[model samples]
Target: MPAATSTAEAAGPTAERAPHTGPIRWIVVGSLLTGLLLAAVLSLVVFAGAPEHVITGSALLGFAAGWALLAVLSAWMTSQPQRWAWVPTAGLAATGLGLLVVAPGDGGLTAAGWVWPPALLTMAVWIGVRIRRALAAGSGRWLLYPVVVVIAASAVGGAVETVGLASDDPGRAMPGEVYDVGSYRLHLNCTGSGGPTVVLFNGLGLTSANWARVVPGVARSARVCAYDRAGQGWSEDAPQPRDGNQAAADLHALLQRAGEEGPYVLVGHSIGGDHAMIYAARYPEQVAGMVLLDATDPYRVGGGPPSAMAVLPSLARLGVGRLPPTSYWSTLPEPAAGQVRMFNANPRGWRNVRDEIATLPALLTQARDLTTLGDMPLVVLTAAGAEDDPARLAGQERMAALSTNSSHRPADAGHGALLDEERGAASSVQAVQDVVQAVRAGTPLL
Candidate 1:
């Protein structure tokens, strides 16, 4: 009887402890889930309303809050406390605080890239080791494992992107001359040698590298120059409010500084067409001819909400943009294709996209200033199926009507394909050549 009693007493403590441990494990799981939800909500709420400079930091702080929650809850409820959670909590809090206090802008965020990735990786590794030792075989470690893995993945991705940024040198990859266009520099790669130089203007988010296929075809007959506008490709960034007028002014300064004489044939694709029109309007005597390749109508309206501008840059800085494959630029030939891929992956480039989109409404409004092109030799090449949209077709016709010597031609290709695909690019090449020929002959287009 005494032996049985002794055994019962020995089992009593473990039996009582089992209930507490089981509930605590479940509570830890619940805490993790709740923390994740809180993190998401806080990030969204902060990003929606916070100032542009503080949005990234606020988002990071939200994540830190989640980790802090885990630390507090585990220590308060569980017998085997996850005190190690404080490490990540403290690290994230410090980083977020630094970003907020410094207000470092894009340059600061870029420099921070070199610091955070390895730091995060080390923190994650330490957390994993602590987790293995602190948590028993089946006590809520599974819940925390996924979070650790995600952190590690993010760290690795950031490292890869940092390395890519370090290696990508625009001067070495692109054959161009960088000229000081006022305060900032612009990259211009001009090829061939002839009268009436064809200055190529890229579409939204495009650079000189995108003109690889079109430039070669046009350079066969006339001098073709393609340039990266401020904050794109190899060019240095300029101030904000980068509207059409600003872009035109920059182009004017760039050409004059580079000694690329005027009375030039302007070849603009997509939004570049709108920029060309603005340029022609601003400097009537300098523009000899124009070729619009699936150009965006200056009158067109609609863009993403303004808040997206704040979120996009932050996401890009975190290496979210590089998660996708570089296959999008595969249609472009080697070297150029590689160059495009590298630039697109850059966080600064994404910020440029944000700034451009933010001012698009103003840009479109400014484009309305161009009322006519008079007798300028102009070709408006519309992509296939563009005519399906009545409004779009009308806009194209209107642009064509601006010039007395203009012709509206339909290319059998998609808008982007007009420059990306060989067949479509050939059609674009022909349009530029036709305008060039007309300009030289001083006659109407055929």
Candidate 2:
């Protein structure tokens, strides 16, 4: 009886500690979950309403579903916050950091770019403090939990960055003609039947399909061709560097090989203007007229690649090759929307974009010396909304001055005005048709 009583006394303190320890465990679990939820919310903010593109309803739903699943897991693993829940908590933190890097610079605070890092770091510090205090008090050793959490988070992030979600259906080629340009196979789509072939060049990081909205209208008057550059759309990556000169060379080769005879009216958007200019300069006889659509000026694009461009390959390594459900697609119709989705899924697209950005400085430098058009009919279509900047308008004016017979038409549209849902594309089509008419008539183009 004395032995039994002594044993009961020895177990009394441990029994009492159980209630006290339970509350502390719950507190730790709560803190971990709060950190994770905060991280996830910040990520959502970064991806949603990003300045680069509009976040689609489906993407938002996917984000919510991803968060909800994590939340449920966090709740279920409350008892094992240190052992089980920390992995996801660290994952949330890593993903938030990745979002900070991927979020467009123009997004500012709305992107939650400024908020996430500090919040996540603070949480990590807080966790460390708790672990240190617990150890000092001789309560328990909690160091392994935080470390494991961090390692697990990094692993998941690395996996995501490396293996990322590739589309099950990746190879949906655009409806077009594929040409073997020796170095690469370039995809070209054409419509209508007439003289002075209208060739369309997509803006930076965009595919030939970007002109889908405007092609039908232009095809009514002239044969219009929109071709994807190497490593874009249905085209394969090229051994040559992605440069304006290379692009111009590829276009010339494709035209010659495909038996698409020209005297062509070249239409270029954004950076494509540089390539069109190069094409006209290199093969003067082949180009009859030129159309510059909200194009980038060689002088205006700053020296060196953008900081974001440098970070893209790193993000790709982190398994985020593409961010889909872009806002631009919302403006497009059904078949076009579906095509954009497939384009978004292509991992090579980002690699190609990176290469283009890397070579922009060199391309712009090369463009500084492109031969003048002399008297070739030229039309410069400036987006009214984008031309609000005096400097931008000045650049557009300068482009119009490239030819003795040139006209600058201000369209009621934004930078990507051709893709605008309303009359933006129609305005551009009219400009192209007018240029074609002027070139054929040998009349002065205002």
lDDT of each: 0.81, 0.65
lDDT of 2 by residue, 126-234 (tens): 6565455432232233623565466345335444433333332434545767889886688888889898999998878788777778888889988999888887877
lDDT of 1 by residue, 236-274 (tens): 888654788999999999999989997999889888888
Each prediction's total of clashing residue pairs, residues at least 3 apart in sequence or on different chains, is 0, 6
Model 1: runs farther than 4 Å from truth?
1-45, 48-53, 77-80, 105-107, 136-139, 304-313, 316-326
CA shift at 28, candidate 1, in angstroms? 4.7
lDDT of 2 at 395: 81
Q: After TM-score superposition, what is the CA distance of residue 277 in candidate 1 from its true location, in Å?
A: 1.8
| Model 2 lDDT, residue 389, Cα | 85
* Worst window of 10 by summed lDDT in candidate 1: 43-52
Q: After superposition, how far is residue 22 of candidate 2 from its true place, in Å?
A: 20
State, as a TM-score between 0 and 1, how close model 1 is to the true structure.
0.89
Candidate 2 TM-score versus the reference = 0.65
